[model samples]
Target: MASGQWRALAEQFQLICPSGGAPGVGSPGALPGLASCGHWVNVAGLQGWVQALLDQGIPSFRCPRCPESPWLWQELCKLGLFTDEARARLEAQILVQEGATGSYRQCPRCQRLVQRLEPGPLRTPCLPCSQQARRLYCFCWGCGRDWPDTSPHADPRCPLQAALHDAPKIQAPPSSLHGCPSLRACPRCYALLSHTLQGYPSVICPECHCVFCYRCLGLSGGHRLPCQIADRQLVCGREAVTLLPMGAQ
Candidate 1:
């Protein structure tokens, strides 16, 4: 990326550390090539990181190979820091270390070796951590919101409903569910789950994981529905039932 573009991104994302801080400008022990501006970053495995960033909707960011430490990238790749190669290393290390401490080995994801605190063993990736760092690097473009997740309307500012309003829906093949009817969002509330209300106009949900047609949800409705995980469905002498198509039986 161009130096100007990098500066714009830094300004936009707040990536630069404050002066005199660890990554601050002109620090002697700072990463090579960053001594002058302090924004010099030695992101060795930055290509993969940048790809992940792009998948999350960050535009026009590039990870440049540090001419000096191109070998560092190769070293990280060989060590399998971001791949499953490190899993065996992590497992063996944990087995040796935790046994001495009188603890069983654990992998949080697999739970085979549960004592290792390393990121490779713990299944969850630290995307939220990276997003938090990105915020520190760049200025807020739109109103700040949580990073995107699996929700249909994941983009906080430009929701899926707004983006899909004008798109055409196609009919499905003969072997299909619901004949591929074009979905319509709630005109009032803007949700993907605006199906017709059949049984109860209001269902009292205890765990409150219910998503309903606008008519069946919200504060004025004065109703709550249990999440799928709730042990019991009934609350206050009423029970909430999920309504799916007859074929969904």
Candidate 2:
């Protein structure tokens, strides 16, 4: 292709990848994983195009993939997108029995179709409201229902996972002296949050609701009281005793 033609082709192929994480086609600068398969075809060739992409673990996607056709699932299945492991799980659990209409696999308990099935038997967890809070264990990726995660599992998102990746590892700017006794600086936002009493259990960030333990100065909640963070975990932690009004105390 000519130099001008190459630029035009690049522009034409610069399709944005959805947040669903199909791969970023928004820019040519993106890495191979982020870039499209470079097949560059319309809906007619979507099936073949995606297959070629997934063969290399590169997700293929395009804009306006709506009016979901019935054949979409069948085509995806034919491509072996649903792995064998998933099928094995679905074997014993009946997904949707024959002659059942107006609903997908009825929840064994609630009989609701709000839950979506994916990759054969790798079905999502049950809805929390549909069942009780205590009985439910695993989370359903379909309805997005679950209890506050204590330990780690294949919950898609790490509940134990902190946005520590998003923000600075240790960012504790010293608070100006002579602030309210109830006030403490938020490491995440750098704003001051007010607690009811000195050395309170947790200081709830009014802006972000990001709970931080006043004692240990680590991200915490009512679930984990008295944060045992003896050693300073902040990235570049500095201890600055905040000044409080003497008359108030």
lDDT of each: 0.30, 0.34
With candidate 2 superimposed using the best TM-score fit, by how many Å does residue 38's alpha carbon deviate from the native? 24
lDDT of 2 at 151: 47
Best by TM-score: 2
Tens-digit lDDT string for candidate 1 (1-249): 455654454344333333424543533443322422233443332334433433444322332322122222222222223444444543344344312221222322223322211212112222224344563121111112232333332334333422232122323333221121133333233344322233532323323444332222232233433212111111111222233322121
Residue 99's lDDT within candidate 2 is 15
TM-score of each: 0.17, 0.20
- Name the top lDDT candidate: 2
Q: For candidate 2, what is the lDDT? A: 0.34
Candidate 2 residue spans exceeding 4 A from truth: 1-48, 51-75, 78-139, 142-204, 207-249
Q: Write the per-residue lDDT of candidate 2 for residues 73-183, one digit (tens) a residue.
A: 222333323444543333213232221111233343433323222223223344433246554434332222343343443443321111211111222324321122233
Q: Looking at model 2, report the run of 10 residues with the lowest lDDT sum.
A: 159-168
lDDT of 1: 0.30
Query: How many Å off is the CA of 225 in candidate 1?
Result: 15
